[model samples]
Target chain A: MTLIAADFGKLGRSTLMSVASMLALAILAPVLVAALRADSIPAVKLNADQIAPRAIEELTGRNVTRDYAYAWRDLAAASESARADLLNDYFTGFAKDKLVRRIADQQKTGVRIRYIDHGHNVRALFYAPDGGEMQLVDNAQLEIEIRDGSKIIYREKVNQQYLVLMTPGADRWFVRSLDQLADHP
Target chain B: MAKMHSLVFVPALALSLVSSAQVPTLQVPARLIAGQAFTIPTHGQGEKTFYLLGPGSVVKRTVELGTEVKVTGAEIAAAGRYLALSCGSDGCSGTDFFVLPGDAVKISFLLHPSRVPVTAHNAINATAFVFDQFHNPVLRPVTVDFRVLPKNGPAFTKSVKTVQGVAWSEMSPAAKEGPVKVIATVGEQEEPRVIQQVASEACNLRIKARRTSKGVEVETDPVRDCHGNAVPDGTIVSVTAVDAQGRTTVDAPVKKGIARTQLPIHGSATISVASGVAIGNEIKL
Candidate 1:
């Protein structure tokens, strides 16, 4: 939490005390709300124009978008809480292994990350003929905060690009890979 | 190749710091290999906390502001975007960079249709995704070799080009009914999958009949499929005989490549045989 203390030296003693308290609370309230509230589903728009071998069925398109949103929500929650089990629902294979390792590493180094997801524009690049895997390019908007315990070390808003791979499981689509790209189309 | 991605930290909370214009900028490589050690030169004085965030890792350390900060290769082994941040009393300055994958050394191969009929066309599919040692997909194009080794034919190999780390090819089943092994190769990595090619519908299912003590003994010649493959033993073969005693039918299982059955017939009799969708020649006795 940050309070406006720059101008407090010029103000009166009592006024300065009250103003500092108000400023601290005002800034602290939003941070608390943002951290404590449950992560809502982020908007995910999928474009399958380039998918090959088989055109994406309408139902598959709907299901993939909804599941991708759920994955983002879960990812945000997992990163903030450093809870690896939370990823089991929507993550599998390499994606799950990497995030789980990251959480473990975070706990070791006393570091944490928070992702405030905005939305995503995902383009489907490849769909295996046998329906085992799908590759996508995702352009995402997110606010990321790196923290050392209660101290916010760095925060930024980024337009990130990711190479994503999703595989179908028994009940839902699982994210197998989510690799950040350097703005390549 | 040296590539770099830089991120200037923008405020996420209400806490505003020194204007981004005044915040000290640091020097870092534009691009890095997936598993290589690197350093960032810091400026100013005093000690500051350095945090390196990347895929599958979060590294934090305290270093003297003016000295070079050493980052181990294991800290940022995963390929993707990485952020290097230095936090001091004045606030933090963050820069982002990219880590590209190494050469394609591994492959995840998927072969479909574990069993198919010999008559099927383009029934086997092989799709392979190339990867680095760290399990990151290699975005660059590469050629994948698909080797087909049939149970009873000369083996052949075909090459396909990967698009965005994935390549696929479809193959027709060999005429000979047996198992075919398909192997996908990338660099030194090889993955193999096997699919069975079973016989198609049985054809040339003609049977000969002769009078026996108990009844008319009818036995079929060797049953072969349209592709000339011997029908597998235990396949059902139906035999029917018609006489003054009305019609008699017996469903017999082929054993030793042929099926034999007895049907009680009186006086003149007509006999016929069938297997699957193929009908055999009729015999009159």
Candidate 2:
């Protein structure tokens, strides 16, 4: 009986030792892995050649340079011949002295144009017939904003309402002028 | 015969008592490495019960599913003469089994650069985890593997770059530009980071055959700043590039308001701006 008890005790001791050792190994595994992590490969970097073109094209298209090209032509012509222009025409109850004074003041103060970014949503004003005339009544909706520093100088939506001079000879469209729509500020 | 029996019986009784008093007690010391997590469960039912005991008389440790724990130490004490461990929960019987410490949780988090658009020049930002086995993001010297394999063209792989502690890589450009995969690894962490990348996004560069004041020109667009924004003249700019093999190559000095070396071919150049440039309103290239 004594012999049997001794043997059982020895077996129990060995079993406990084995359990302890196994536990020790388990505890060490994560430490070993983390220590050796530096030998592992780092995340890779790729060339940006593929993504740049698409971003540039997308940004350019959204800015409306090609679409509003006709706006420049109308503004340039009307500004030169202020007498024939409706907004500048003296007979339309609009005074040339006020118009010239505004132009002279703009030249003196260097009043520039700018765009406003209304977060994700954008709204703006443009002018009729390329935006050269100073008629405050003929503003249209603009697709984009023209800016000068922090100030919003012009927009597309406002001018688009009064004048439909987008097509040059009913085909090509260009911005005739930039001064059609002016920001209040 | 009675005297002899008495002598033997007394010794036997004393020996039994002594043996019973010599129960072997044990306590195992352990620590959970930082930056890692582990899980341990002990369950018992009916007469057979199990108890997972820890330090500070803490009992009935509940381990939820998907939860990880850190082990500090373990002790085994019993009343038997043998070194047998008995697991018990109140009235339930308990068996002493080996408990392993959690080790897998210690590995660092590796990350991959997000998908950026393709540019004339190709570059990407990649990073690796900066941690040890203890789930601590400690700074350590590590080997990093960066790979940029072209998806459409020839296969190209770069040598492993050695990084110290945690640092970002310079802009790396590729000769051939197209769809490609970027992979990074550090320690046990692989591509797609446990954390963010160290480097910034690679710049997209292009060479345009544009109408210049001097004549028809094949050069990078002047309107777009180093960041590729349409800026007027006099905007300060800087451009940097890295190759496919993780080799950084900065261009020679920029003369005449242009800041980068132009490739003879029309397409293929990745550019990134570090500082000093503004985007203009009109085509101000």
Candidate 3:
């Protein structure tokens, strides 16, 4: 009876060791497979040409360019009462006030400034680290007519350069300042 | 006492004579056209130098007083307000006048968009600016006739009066696909322009598909409008495939003439296509 009991204990110890080894293999098998699979796959290195056509740097600048075009169009197309409402989307602070005053003065003088054709080239000058402010320089060709009362007193083609400051708002970028560079013709 | 009185009286008399001398009077026309000969009348004695200042020009000449100063078109070519000053040994006087625009010599006509889709209430604007020979904008109210010639359709005509040197009108494009000719006429001067009219949208869009090695290849017939005109290239056509696994969609643009896409199908599926708001017939595979 002692020999038989000692033999049963030895068998139990061997069976426990086998079960523990099996359990450890079961746990480590998935990790080993995953590592091997990861090693088999090639590392991806993206070239500049493979990047998206519209880079992150250009996204905000494009919005400002489109808004600038619309702002000038609204100025030429809106009525007296509607001018302020139309321009509210494009300008802010002192720029907005200045545009409003200019429109009012034009209305009082019976002056209508019509924009015939406008084309512009925008170059990004600076972008703030916080992404709050942006500066752009625009070189533009403008065909315009200046009318006084019932007479178009002046008509010409003008080449203009502007230093534009913009700030991001809740919906779109707003023009903080549009100062005309005096050096351009 | 007599000599003292004469001294005081002589100085006073001289002062009165100088002050009483008639100031030169200048006569100028109230309105003059640009690039036209004009004359300014002055009244005085002895030779007087006159300076004429106007937009884009300046003239200084000595002329006999009581005569007129003649100016040619080249001298007073620019249209704006002008000032003429007469300065003599006796006194100085000045007068101002306005220069108006001359007759229409050329027309600047602009048509927006350069292309349009044929739909009612889709408006295209035509704006005209009449200019003089010297390129000055003519301010007078002139009648302008706008004519639109459509392919295989009746031509449209309208007359508009210029206000502040501009005449603009809005017209709807014809309901057909072809080149459109627009002409603006004022007297003998005419400006001709062209705009391309394209089909409105895709209608009756239908597609067919067959099994391929890669996936289920599906392609649309040449898309057409209700009038049977082929939809222009680059119009977006959307294709959707629905199977046991959910749905996949591809928005393909029309190239050459059709929009085609391949979808991987697991089991029996349904395919549908659409262009703009127009939906096409669906097929079960």
DockQ score of each predicted structure, in the order shown: 0.19, 0.01, 0.01
What would the TM-scores of all predictions be? 0.77, 0.21, 0.51
> What is the model-wide C-alpha lDDT for candidate 2?
0.29
> How would you encode candidate 3's per-residue C-alpha lDDT over B209-283 as one tens digit per residue?
998987798899999888777798888999999999999898988987798888888578999999989999899
- Candidate 2 C-alpha lDDT tens digits along A1-185: 99998987988988988999999999877766421111112121112122211222343333333333222222223232221242231111112222333334333333322222111111121211221211111222223332223433223322221211111223332322111111210
**What's the lDDT for residue B76 in model 1?**
76
How is the predicted docking of candidate 1 categorized under the CAPRI scheme?
incorrect
Worst 10 residues of 2 chain B by lDDT: B8-17
- Give per-residue CA lDDT, model 1, range B31-139, as digits (tens): 7888789889988889988888888898888999889999887877789887777777777776777788888999999998898889989878899989998888887
Error of 3 at A163 (Å): 30
Off by over 4 Å in 3: A1-185, B1-22, B29-31, B39-50, B55-70, B87-91, B244-247, B264-267
Write the candidate numbers in order of decreasing DockQ: 1, 3, 2
Q: Model 1, which residues run further than 4 Å from truth?
A: A1-39, B1-23, B204-223, B232-285
- Ranking of models by TM-score: 1, 3, 2
Q: Which of candidates 2 and 3 is the stronger one according to lDDT?
A: 3
Fraction of native contacts in model 1? 0.41
Tell me the TM-score of model 3: 0.51
